[model samples]
Target: MSDPFIPFESISYTKRFLADCYERQSFANAKTVSYHTSYSFIYHLQQGRLYLQQAAQAPIEIKPMLLFYGIVQMLKACVLTVDPFYPENSTVLAHGVTARKRKKQGYRFLDDEIKVQKNGLFLHFLDKMFHVKQMPDEKYKMNFLLKQVADMHPLYSTMHNQDISIAVTQKSQSYMISDTILDDLHMTANRFSLFLEQSPNSKSWFHRQKGITALKQQITVPLHAAPTRYQSAPWLSTCDGDIYMLRKREDYCSLPELSIHYLLLYNLSMICRYEAEWWGELHHTFEGNDLPFIKQFLTSTTKKLPLLFEHYLFSINER
Candidate 1:
């Protein structure tokens, strides 16, 4: 297998990344901190790479445990680059989110929800890395989060018979979106256009083509939120190839991709660790939609997270 982190594993690469962060932050102790912190940052990322590599080959039963640790390691590395004084308190050391202690009967992973806590890694990571602070007590269902992942749309199409993602074509600086987004949105073209105008994410909404809608993203949009901040949808522009728009655009759908993955993986890791009875049944029995979604999700995250890490850390988009 080729190196998942070829030049990225090099110490110099992390040093440069840290140097950039130091410059961006203008830290008072940049000289001392950058030197010492680079070592920890590089190792955390390397360990993350290792854990995710193991997850890819590991059996389905053990994959989530590996993925959770892998994700945490990467998150720690990311935190260091952004905020050198991470773990300023013990609260940031915690996972920062909680799963239900006792799952109700007939529980499906899709319907299961996780509560964002007041403090911990989840809170710290999002606030530090993405500049977004969410309501701690809010609850999010697994299916809602999963729908935010564009690649997972196919499984949803198969199982739920829904199009969670729409492919977009680029036209110069803007992108051409599909009007199919309006189907489930219950909005006419004019209302949908009006909706985009009010959305924080929308820089400009061009006219709808034969069936295409076009918009340039407001790249500098600050990610602060009100209760209705998520009334808008998410638009991710890949460095290369196709772009996708998630339909419906509900709450959390507009969240940064990193946060989306972290939340999904957190719930998954919890189910893997705590809900063994249900997890075992899903794996061994392979009867319901749960196993398929679980298997597909694990597969999706394993492939996508590393590439996303590269983008977050180094501005490199591998795919």
Candidate 2:
């Protein structure tokens, strides 16, 4: 099952929270810009919410376009929290990623790819949120993005007979990762332990639970410190009463899950807006695996993206 939608409180009441965020982050001239920044924040957030709400009533043909705008607005709001004066210039306003539309035979959305642009919301978002510098000029495939989500765990398992995750169970202060993950990641316990240590947001180095075999033959290891037990790479999600550490394609390990969501919505929105005939045919024919993957991805996005950003927005309030 996918993550349940747990969007943050309504946008109407978040101006104060946002202003405070500006001040808390100690952005230059926080006092001078917080008012205007908070206003923009509310506008972006409201627009995001409105678009997603509209997408809920939209048909499949139009859903991606609406959802992409919604997702972009949400991201803009998040960026404002950090940048204070976002869009410092017009160049940052572009989609930041471009999709290639080839008329070659057997064109499938699953095999479709999007290339990351050097500057734009995608790059700025990555820099501000994750502090990633110098991404390669590489095209990321849709299938690669799909495999990163926990929601797709069941879908891929059922359809292709391929498992994408290692079951993770959390008990109080620690998470037990399925040792079966060893074969999936092709790493020994020590190597895997080292891998997790190098992940983003590594506050404390985690180690294996000593001298005991966890139930169901899992390896018990605590991922973070108390009260804010965040997951690192090979993501650990506390949602839905279990943790799913998804094993994704190469170069995906370091990316934030939200980035993948953004890329998916970006490409789909491009298809919906620019590739009319192809999109129309796909919707009418219900052909192949693309439809189901896109269907499930949208379902997962509308429900989870806002919640993920909500968690992010509020979490930084502590800083």
Candidate 3:
């Protein structure tokens, strides 16, 4: 056999190029599935967060639409987790369609799909799972967070339509996005990331590995019922849906003895508190010009969110 010439600049370059090519091929061959279980939902939610973080920290000029797109993906994952069989929104076509045509036209808008089904089974599911009646009307509630995300559509469209050359500017040899817009984007991305991770439904191999401990008795603090002043700073929720207030002074003594479930709940509750603070700032500090959009977004988004999020957001804001 005759010796063959290689095309890459170097051996390392050839290896890296081939690896990337194989990765792309593998991704293309992969089939998309509904995230009906805890595992799939967490996976997609984390992927969305990863992309948002990457977009936020990118040094070069990058469209924030990437972040918004990731948020939409997270939203889809969330809705699917609630109702795996939720019908896809179809703008056209009737029930009688050829298989090939159905496959070709199966594409659906995430926003539209969510909106149509929001008030039905999903809402009922939320109410039952999260105790929606106990959640407050206003605040950085889960519903509010989701609404903020949904309201980004108009902003996304505005950014998406802008001329790239005009939207970005070079300053001191570095490209920069508008300070106001960038700040909002960063805040929104961070909020969504926190919400998804702290969400009660959030579960993963990592969390499982930590080992959960089922308590002997229900704590019965009713963390989600009505907000009441507690002497302790952190509270833990048992698997049976009871809350126990953990005193700050006892941390040193109790920290080492607590189970993974308590530790996780405590950490998640803290994140929820942080989210509330951020929501307060965002609500009060936003410019007058943006208030109308924010208000409208909140109204529409809240209507579409699951009831569980509404309660979760309210429960965390209690402290």
Clashes of each: 0, 0, 0
Q: lDDT values of the candidates?
A: 0.70, 0.72, 0.29
Clashes of 3: 0
**In terms of TM-score, how similar is model 1 to the real structure?**
0.82
Total backbone clashes of candidate 2, pairs 3 or more residues apart or in separate chains: 0
Which ten-residue region of model 1 has the weakest summed lDDT? 221-230
What are the per-residue Cα lDDT tens digits for candidate 1 across 196-311?
55543343233323222334531111122211111124554332334566666563254677777788888888887888898888867767688787788888889878777776
Q: Per-residue lDDT of 36-96 in model 2, one digit per residue for the tens?
A: 7766777788788889889888888898989889989988988987888789999899878
Output the number of the lDDT-best candidate.
2
Instruction: List residue ranges in candidate 1 displaced over 4 A.
Output: 1-4, 180-233, 236-241, 316-319
lDDT of 3: 0.29
Tens-place lDDT per residue, model 3, 23-102, is 44343322232212334444555565565456445421231233433444444443443333333443211211111112
Candidate 1 vs candidate 2: the lDDT winner is 2
